[model samples]
Target chain A: MKRNIRLLIEYDGGRYRGWQKQGKNADADTIQGRLEQVLSRMTGEDVQLIGSGRTDAGVHALGQVANFHTDCGMSCGEIRDYLTRYLPADIGILKVSDAGERFHSRLNAAEKTYCYRIAVPGVPHVFDRKYLWHFPEPLDMKKMEQAADFLTGRHDFKGFSSIKRTKKSTVRELYAIDIEKKEKEILISFTGNGFLHNMVRILTGTLVEIGCGRKQPEDVLTVLQTKDRQDAGMTAPPQGLFLVSVKY
Target chain B: MKRNIRLLIEYDGGRYRGWQKQGKNADADTIQGRLEQVLSRMTGEDVQLIGSGRTDAGVHALGQVANFHTDCGMSCGEIRDYLTRYLPADIGILKVSDAGERFHSRLNAAEKTYCYRIAVPGVPHVFDRKYLWHFPEPLDMKKMEQAADFLTGRHDFKGFSSIKRTKKSTVRELYAIDIEKKEKEILISFTGNGFLHNMVRILTGTLVEIGCGRKQPEDVLTVLQTKDRQDAGMTAPPQGLFLVSVKY
Candidate 1:
C-alpha cells in the first residue's frame, strides 16, 4: 500500500547546501538528499521527497515542511525513530504524520513565515553567533517601520528580488512585516502568501538601509514602481535568516 | 611597569579543550591558549591569563572572568579591538579593564554561579542543540527540588565530585540550588563560594537520578555524609553545563 507521509523538520542549515538534492555532493550536502537516502534504505524503495521551498545555504528552519511517498508498511512513529537514530544532530524531526494521498506540501501551502535576527550594537557575538547577523550601527526604528508599512501589501516585488521572470508574474501578497526589537537583538518577521527569489532578504536589507539612514522610507515605493532589482538594497546574508513555518 | 588587566570572556567551548592552556596541542586546542596567542601577538609579551576557574572541555561560559599582567601600552579599547579582530568567532571578550595589581580572577571571586540546561521530552534538538542536554524522559521536578534541598547548605561535597582532596578542606558553602522549568527546558542553577572538580556535573547527575526515581531524594545526604564518590550518581556530560558568572 502506498502512503503519503508529511514531516515537520527542524535543521541548523549551517552545513547543508539548502533543501534540494542537487550537485555532485547530493547525498552528503543537501537535506533532501540525506532524507531520501535514509528513507530509501529504511523502506527498500526509492523515495521522492517534496519540499515546500528551497532555503539558501546557511539558512536555518524551525518548521520546514516536506512530504514523501513510500510503499513501506512501517508506522509513522517507527519511521520517525529510525530517522532520528540515523540523522545527524543538526537536523531533527519534530512531527511525522501520514497525510493522505492528495496532500502536496508545495501546492497546498497558503502562507509562509520567515524570521531574520539581527544582533544590534553593544552586543558581543558569543555562542549562537552562527544564527545572528551583527549589525553594529544603531538603527532608527521609526524609519524602518515606515518602510515596512510600504512593503506590506500585494505588489510586484520584482524590484526586491534577484529573479527576472518573464513567464510568471512577480506579484506577491505580503500580509505583514513586523519589526520587533528585544534587548540587543532585532527580529524582523515576514508573513506572506509567497516570496520571490531573495525577496524577503532583499526587503530586509532595503529596510535596514532606511533604518541606518542610507535610504529614505519612501524608497520602497520607488523600488516597487521601478520593478528593478538594482533599486533594492543588498540581500541580507543567509546566516541570519530562518524559515519559521509553512502553513496550509 | 606591569599593568594588571581584567577581561570578561564568553565562549561556546564546543571545540576547545577547557579553559587552561595545557597539553602539547596548546594554542590550537584550548580557550586560554588561543587567548594567550592573540594577546602575545598584540602586546609582544607572553601573556599568562588566569581564569576564575577551569571549566570542562565541552562546558560553555557566558561570563568567565580572567586577569593577566602585561607591559603593553595599548589602551583598553584598542586591546579589545585587537583581541576581537584576532580571536575566533566562538570566543568573545565582553569587557577589558585595567584592574589593580592586587586583583586576581581566581582569588578575589566571592561567589560563582553555574547553570545547567536540560531539554525535556517532546522537544527537538536543532540549531542550539550543542548547548542543551536532551533527556527524552519527563522529569519529576518536585523530586529534583527535594534532592536540591538535601544538597544545599554548607557541607563537605566530596561525594558529589570526582576529586580526592586531602590537603584542602573539602567543605564548601553551597548558598542556593534553584531549579526552574520553562516550556520544554529545565534550568538548574547553582550558586556557591566554590565548586570542586566535576562537582556541578556530578551534583546535576545525582539530582537527575533522584528525579527519574533511580535514587531517593535523601540519597544526597547519604552521599555527602559518606564522603564517597561511589555513593553519588553518574557524572553528567560537560556540554549542558555553563559557567554563568563569577562575582568579585
Candidate 2:
C-alpha cells in the first residue's frame, strides 16, 4: 500500500547547486539528492521525493513542502525521527504528516510566500552572510514601498520573470507585495497563488533600483504593461530570496 | 613615517587554519595574510597587521580590529573606498580611521566579548549551517544558567584552555558570563580581559552538558578547582563561537 506523506523541509541552499539533481560535480550536491539519500537508507528502498517547487541555487526555504509515497508502515513521528537522524546537517524535516490520497504537494497548494532580504551595510554580516544580499549604500524605504504597491495585484508578470523557456504559462496572480524594514535589514515579501521563473527576484531587483533612486515607482507599472522580459530590472542574487511558506 | 590606520578585517577561517598564522599553515591565507596583501598593494611596502586575537579554523569574525603602518597619505574615507573596491567579496572593510601612532588594537583593548550561538534542532539551518552548531535536543536553560554562574569570576581556567602548548600565563580574569535564550537559539556571551585558548567553547560545552542533565552545576566548580584539562567538559565545536567585539 502506498502511503502519502507530507514533509516540511528547511534547507541551507549555499552548499547545493539548487533543489534539482544535476550532473555530478563533487560540489554539485542538491537538496533533493540529500533527501533521497536519507530516505533510501532509512527504508532500504530507493525513494524519490517530490517538492512543491524548485528553488534556485543559493536560495533558502524555511517552510518548503514536499511529499513522497512509501510503504514503510511507520507513523508520522517515526518517519520524522528517521529522517532527522539520517539527513545531512543542512537539510531538516520540521514536520511530517499523512497527506490525502490524491493530494500533491505542488498542484494542491493554495498559496506561497517568498521573502527577499537585503543587508544595508555593504559589509557582509559575519553571521548572516549566507542569508542576505549586502548593499553598503543606504536605501530609501519610502521609494521601495511606493514601487512595491504597484506589484500588489494579479497581473501578467512576463516582464518580471526570467526569459527561460518553459511549458507553464507565465501568468501569475500576485495576492500581495509588502516591504518591511528592521534595523539594517529590508525584507520584501510576496504572497501569491504561484510565481513564474525568477519572478520574485526580478521584481526585487526592480524595486531595489527604485529604492536607490535609479528608477521611478511608475516604472513598475510600465514594466508590467510591456509584458517583455527586457523591460524588467536585473535579477537579484539568489542568496537573498527565501520560500517562507506554502498554504494548503 | 608611521601612519596609524584602523582596519576592519573580514576573513573566512576555513581556508587557513586560524587567525594567528602558526605551524605548517602559518604562511597560508589567513585573515592577516589577506589584509596584508591588500595593505601591501596599497602602500608598496611589507605590512604587518596585528589582529584582536587568534580565532581557530572555521571560526569567523565580524568586527575584527587590526592596525597597519601605511605611508599612503590618503584620508580614512579614501582608504576605505580603495579597499572596498579591491578586497574579495568574502572580506570587506566596514570602516577605516586614522588612529594615534601609539594605538594598538590588541594592547589598548579593555574588554573582549565573545558570543557562542547554538541552533537546537537536528537539521542545520541552510543559511547558518556554516556558522552555527546544530544540537537536536531541547536544552534546559535553568541548568545551563546555573552551570554558567559558577564560571563568572576570576579563576584558574587552565582546565578550559586547549591542551596545546602556550607561552602566555594561564591565569585570566572573567568579568561576566551570561547565557541568553531567543526563540530556539541559545547565545552564551563571555566578557573578560582575555580568554585562554578554546576557553569560551569549553565553557559552553560544560554548560551544554549541564543543560542536557548529564552533569550538575556544581561539577563546573569542581572542574575549575581541579585545574585539569581532562576534568572539564567536552570542547564545543568552533562554529558556534564568534569574536563579537574588542573594546578599546
Candidate 3:
C-alpha cells in the first residue's frame, strides 16, 4: 500500500534550469528532478514528485509545496530528517508529513505570492546580488503605485504574458500589488490566484517603465483590453523574482 | 602628483581568500587583489589597495573601508562608477571619495562590528544557506548571554584566538555583545576596538558551546585567564561571520 506524503519546500533556483524536469535528451537540471532522485533513493522505489507550480530559472522559492506517494514505512520524522540531511545545500525540506489520499499539490493550491526586489539606486549589493535586480536608475514610486492600481483585480492578462497562444483561459485574479521600500531595496509583491506565463514579470516591467516615465500610468489599461503581447513592456529578469508562499 | 582616495567597500568573501591579497605567486583571488587590479587599469598605474583589515576566506563584509593613492584624473563619481562596473558581482564598491593624504584604512579605524548568524533549529534556509550556520541543536540563549558577559570589557584575549605567540599585545577593548533572536535565526554581534586573528570565530564557538550546555557559562572566565587556545570550544566556520562595519 502506498502512503501519500506532502512536503513544504524551498530552494535557490539560480543553479537549476527551472522547477520541471525536462525528459531525457534535454537539460534536465531541475528542482523536480533532484527531489525525485532523492525521494526515490530514500523510499527504495520510483517516486513522482508533484509541485504546486513551476518557478522560472534564476527564480527562488521560500514556501513551495509538493507531494508524492511512497511505499516506505519510515516514520515522517525519519523521512524528514533523512531528506533534509541528504538534499543538496541549495535545496531545503521545510516539512514532511502524511497527507490525505485525495490531496494534490498542484490542484489544491489556492493562491501564490511572489516578490520582486530592485536594488535602490546608488546602493551596493554583494551578498544579495543574485537575489536582486540592480536597476540603478531612479524611479517614481507614486507613478509605479498608480500603474500598479491598473493591474489589481481580475483581468485578462494575455497581453501581459509571453504566451502567444494558449487553449487555457488567460484570465487571472490579481488580488493585490504592493510596492514597499526597504532600506536598500524596493520590494514589490504580488498576490494572485494564478499568473499566466511571464505575467508577473511583464506586469512588473510595464510598471517599471511607467515609473521611469517611459510609459504612462494608464497604458496598462489599453494593453489589457487589446490583449496584444507587444503592447506590454519587457519581461523582468527571473533572478529578482521569489515565490514567497503558496496557500492551500 | 598623487591624490588620496578612500573606498567604502562590501563583498561576499565566499569566492575569495579573504580581504587581503596574498602576495604574488600565491592564491591571488582576494578582494584587495581584485580592487587593485581594477584601480591599476583605470588609473594607468600600479595601485596598492589597503583594506581596513583581513577577513578569513568565506567570511563576508558589509562596510569594509579601504584607501589607495593614484594620479588618476577621474572624478570621484567616475571612479566609483568604473570600479563598480568593472568588479565582479560578488565584490561591490559602495562609495569612493577623496581623503586626506594622511588617512590610513587600517590604523585610523576606531572600532569594528561583526555579526554571526545561526539558523534556528529545524528551520529551512535555502537562499540564505551560504549566509547562515545551519545548527539544528537547540541553543540556550540565557546561557549564551552569561558566557558573553565574561568576555566583555578590556581583557587579554590570547586564549580565545588561534595565534600562539605575538609581540603585539593581546589586550583589547570589547565594548558590547548583542545577541538577537529573529524568526528563523539567532544573530550575535560583537563590537570591539580590535580583534585578534580568529578571535571572533573562537569567541562565537565558546559562546555556542555554553549555549548548548557542552560547557558551563562561567567556564569562559577560566579560558580568558589561562591563555590556552584549547580552552576555547571551537572555531566557528567562516561562512557564518560577517564584517558588519569598521568605524573611524
Top DockQ hit: 3
Q: lDDT scores for all predictions?
A: 0.90, 0.81, 0.89
Summarize candidate 3's per-residue lDDT along B139-245 as a digit string, tens digits: 99999998888889999999999988789999999999999989989999999999999999999988888888899998889988998999888899999999999
What TM-score does the A-chain of candidate 2 achieve?
Answer: 0.94
Chain A TM-score values, per prediction: 0.97, 0.94, 0.97
Report the C-alpha lDDT of model 2 over A40-119, residue by residue, as the tens digit. Answer: 77877778788989999888899999998888788888888888777776787889999888889898889999999998
For model 2, the stretches where C-alpha displacement exceeds 4 angstroms are A20-29, A44-48, A119-121, A133-147, A162-169, A181-185, A208-223, B8-12, B23-28, B121-124, B135-144, B163-168, B209-219
User: What lDDT does model 3 reach?
Assistant: 0.89
For model 1, the stretches where C-alpha displacement exceeds 4 angstroms are A1-3, A23-25, A41-45, A69-82, A98-101, A135-142, A210-219, B1-4, B23-25, B40-46, B70-82, B97-101, B135-143
Clashes of each: 0, 2, 0
- Give the Å shift of residue A44 in candidate 3: 3.9
Off by over 4 Å in 3: A1-3, A24-28, A70-78, A97-100, A213-219, B1-3, B24-28, B70-76, B213-219
For DockQ, candidate 1 versus 2, the one ahead is 1
Give the distance in Å from residue A23's predicted Cα in candidate 1 to where it truly belongs.
6.8
Across all models, the iRMS values in order are: 2.2, 2.6, 1.7
lDDT digits (tens) for residues B1-248 of candidate 1: 79999999999899988998786467878999999889988888978889999998999999999999999999999888888877988999899999998999999999999999998755567777888887767779999998898888999998988887678888888999999999768999999999999999999988888888899999998998899999999898889999999999
The sequence of per-residue lDDT tens digits that candidate 1 reaches over residues A1-248 is 68999999999999998888895457879888888888889989878889999988888999999999888889989989888878877888989999988999999999999999998755667877889888767889999999999989899999998887677989999999999999868999999999888888899888888989999999999999999999889899899999999999
